[model samples]
Target: MADTGIPHFCNDLGVTLIEVGSKEFMCIGAKPPFDHPHIFIDLGDDTEHVCPYCSTLYRYNPALAAGEAKPEECVWHDDPEARTAA
Candidate 1:
């Protein structure tokens, strides 16, 4: 799959750092089972922010080329218990 320039929403990835053009961004915590209410975040002067829904951390990386965001994978963990056991 090609890079869509969108932040990865997979919880398995843990903390995800996404590069954005501005301090404001939106997070949906991925699709379907992992999906959460879409919310807008304002980092203001801060360079990093964490999503309140999934606790995914997003950071601003100026080194990233224009129209490029952090890479992400859409993977589903079928066993919810496995996560808790870890």
Candidate 2:
């Protein structure tokens, strides 16, 4: 399910179940794996994951609304113009 296309997080707000190890959603395989404050279901495989802290799902992605440029393609760290020249 992680091979068909791009992975996305469930934008839905509410309490949801997640996998034990993978830390993803329990039922719908329609999202990515949880890595940040929000949990993510595989969306393609229906994996489940739960937060160890507040028992909330967690997920992290740096390319969701990144527009035409991806997080990996960002130049924040390399762009001297965006930084103070010391």
Candidate 3:
């Protein structure tokens, strides 16, 4: 599947909670190679969500910019063109 252009979040560091900017985005259990299936997560009107695969809790914050995460490192960047042809 192609990227949905939404922000991607992860919990590779095993953080208790990840604060995100967008209510709708992807929760890649971790970065690719060691990542689980990228799951689409939508907070809707709620303030928080959890990734079923990794059980990582995510909270939404209006103070953040789209694609931003509290820990910063939780932001997963999927650059298809950067991948080597393998």
Candidate 4:
């Protein structure tokens, strides 16, 4: 996984709307081991987008950092070492 610098998010907390830092990001539905397809979501001109697999709604907040999320736990960090060990 070459880091494209795209932020990743998860809905494991089951929040209604996940406020994210960027309009363009990857939605993992939930955390790994129970996550759906990591779908690339580009809001484009819009401020919101819904994950097609898990129906998780993501809203953009300009005040957030690129990797930040409203609930904080929604921000996902992939573990490359875990993938290698598996």
Q: Each model's RMSD to truth, in Å? A: 8.2, 12.5, 2.0, 1.8
Candidate 3 differs from the real structure by a C-alpha RMSD in angstroms, to one decimal, of 2.0
Pick out the ten consecutive residues of candidate 3 with the lowest summed lDDT: 77-86
What TM-score against the true fold does each predicted structure earn?
0.55, 0.20, 0.87, 0.88
Backbone-clash count (model 4)? 0
Q: Write the per-residue lDDT of candidate 4 for residues 1-86, one digit (tens) a residue.
A: 45889998999999889999898899988888899878999999999988889988899999998889999999888888987799
lDDT per residue (tens digit) for residues 3-76 in model 3:
66798887889998999999999998977788898889989999998889999999999999988999999998
Winner by TM-score: 4
RMSD of 4: 1.8
**lDDT (CA) per prediction:** 0.57, 0.32, 0.88, 0.89
Error of 1 at 31 (Å): 1.8
Please report how far candidate 1 places residue 65 from its true position, in Å.
5.0
In angstroms, how far off is 48's CA in candidate 1? 0.6
Give candidate 3's whole-model lDDT: 0.88
Instruction: For candidate 1, give the lDDT of residue 56.
Output: 80
The residue ranges of model 1 lying beyond 4 angstroms of the native Cα positions read 1-16, 65-67, 72-86
- Best-to-worst ranking by lDDT: 4, 3, 1, 2
Badly placed stretches (over 4 Å) of model 3 are 1-3, 80-82
Query: How accurate locally is residue 60 in candidate 4, as Cα lDDT from 0 to 100?
Result: 91
